[model samples]
Target: MKHLTVVDHPLVQHKLSHMRDVQTPSHQFRQLLRETSHLLAYEITRNLKSGTREIDTPMQQMEAPVLTGRRPALVSILRAGNGLLDGVLDLVPMARVGFVGLYRDEETLKPVQYYFKVPEQLDQRQVIVVDPMLATGHSAIATISLLKEAGAKDLRFLCLVAAPDGVAAMQDAHPDVPIVTAALDKGLNENGYIYPGLGDAGDRIFGTD
Candidate 1:
């Protein structure tokens, strides 16, 4: 993956547009998110390495390409990340699941960690961190830092949307970790929210105010 990837597939864009609409209900928003996530997962996993394995078919024997190495680890950045995680899992059922719980301090716009758990042998497998929004990028940077500390070397970040500031911050903090998002909006608002973003993803998905 490159330093950044924006998935502009029509289906992804269509669903994202609906998700951005305030009129869309929670159930519909959740459905759209799951559908959009599948498309994003396709783009993110496009570069994964593969090896061939001989298998006997009904008519003949042939070598079939299979994903190489251990199953990739999918680490959700808690709460809203679960929305994306659900759909990604539908695509990559074998992926190992993990979570890092962190909530932002509204006053400071910094991440505060409360929970962390991940698969073993993180150093060997590719780790993909999922979160819905990259606003200030504090939570993402902090989450990736912890994953690195846990021995995750090959890591990638996935989100539904991103702000310019957040992307820049993430790149500055963790240049090696590539970011894949549905859309990169203009920038953040005074309150650290992505402008024209789909509002609070967790709240929208869960029907909270």
Candidate 2:
């Protein structure tokens, strides 16, 4: 996988347009995100390794392809990551799930970790970190570092939208992890929000804003 992959599939772009709309309601926004996540999941998991297994069919015995390795781990970056997590889980029903809780400090525009939990054998399984937005990348960088400390080696970062600054920061901090996003928007605002991004993904998803 490349350092960055923008999933530009038609359906993903279409749903993202609605998500970016300020007038979109929480219920509708949540539905769109769930739908869009499926598409993004397709791209992010494209390179997973597969092997063949011999099985008997009604007609004859033949080899059938199946995923070969241990189940991949889906690590959600708390709150907003849950929205994407649900959809991805729908697709990969057997995937292991985990969470890292962090909130940005408004004054310093940095992430502060509050909670962390992840499945065991991280070094043996592929870990994909999910979050809705990558505005400053502070939370993502911090979360990935913790995962590494916990023995996670193979990892990926998935998001709905990303700012150049965030992408660059991730690349600089963790060059080995590939980043997969639905869209890379114009950049960050003065307050560190991605410009034209679906504002406060947590708020929009929960109707708190």
Candidate 3:
């Protein structure tokens, strides 16, 4: 079974387990999202670009590596994605943040874009698009397509939980952008929600209907 990666870090796994429980409240759920986002941020940015420069340390000059180029732009895919934004920013405080708002229509079952914005000169910056769950994947693909149209060349997608169908959809749609997800669960249920998913991410995070 090609299951999505459930991150091995003890803290990440523990928080995720808590997030999966139905009894978790909105406040704590949001807090968990922030914490997990930071943990995942560590894994995703491990190979980020940096440069070495001479630094003086009391005695003599020493080589030190500092981040190179621009701080990557972090784009959150609307309401649910915002939950991840807090955590990611904690890890990369210098990263510029942007947002794309797209919601799936219950009746049509298609993504609808109500808002979209990205930092200028996205082409020169690496962009990390974030969301808690990769369910149907329409929103992620469409958001990426929009970013591509806006001249974003470098891209990565981050999610906490993903379903097999969504991963396949994203893989087929974007072979260039590698996905970084913590867990790949069984599959999507009939309504296109991930099976055993921590319920609706947006709803859970926002305490909405």
Candidate closer to the true structure by TM-score (higher is better), 1 or 3? 1
RMSD of each: 1.2, 1.2, 1.8
Model 2, 1-209: lDDT tens digits are 24999998989999999999999999999999999999999988887768999999999999999998989999999899999999999999999999999999999999999999899999889899999999999999999999999999989999999999999999999999999999999999899999988899999998996
lDDT for predicted candidate 3 compared with the true structure: 0.87
The CA-based lDDT of model 1 is what? Answer: 0.94
Residue 67, candidate 2: C-alpha displacement in angstroms: 0.8
Candidate 3 TM-score, C-alpha based:
0.95
Residue-wise lDDT of candidate 3 within 112-188, one digit each (tens)?
Answer: 99998889999989999999999988989999999999999988889999888888888788777767887888888
Candidate lDDT scores, in order, read: 0.94, 0.94, 0.87
| Poorest lDDT segment (10 consecutive residues) of candidate 2 | 1-10
The regions of model 2 sitting more than 4 angstroms off are none
RMSD of 2: 1.2
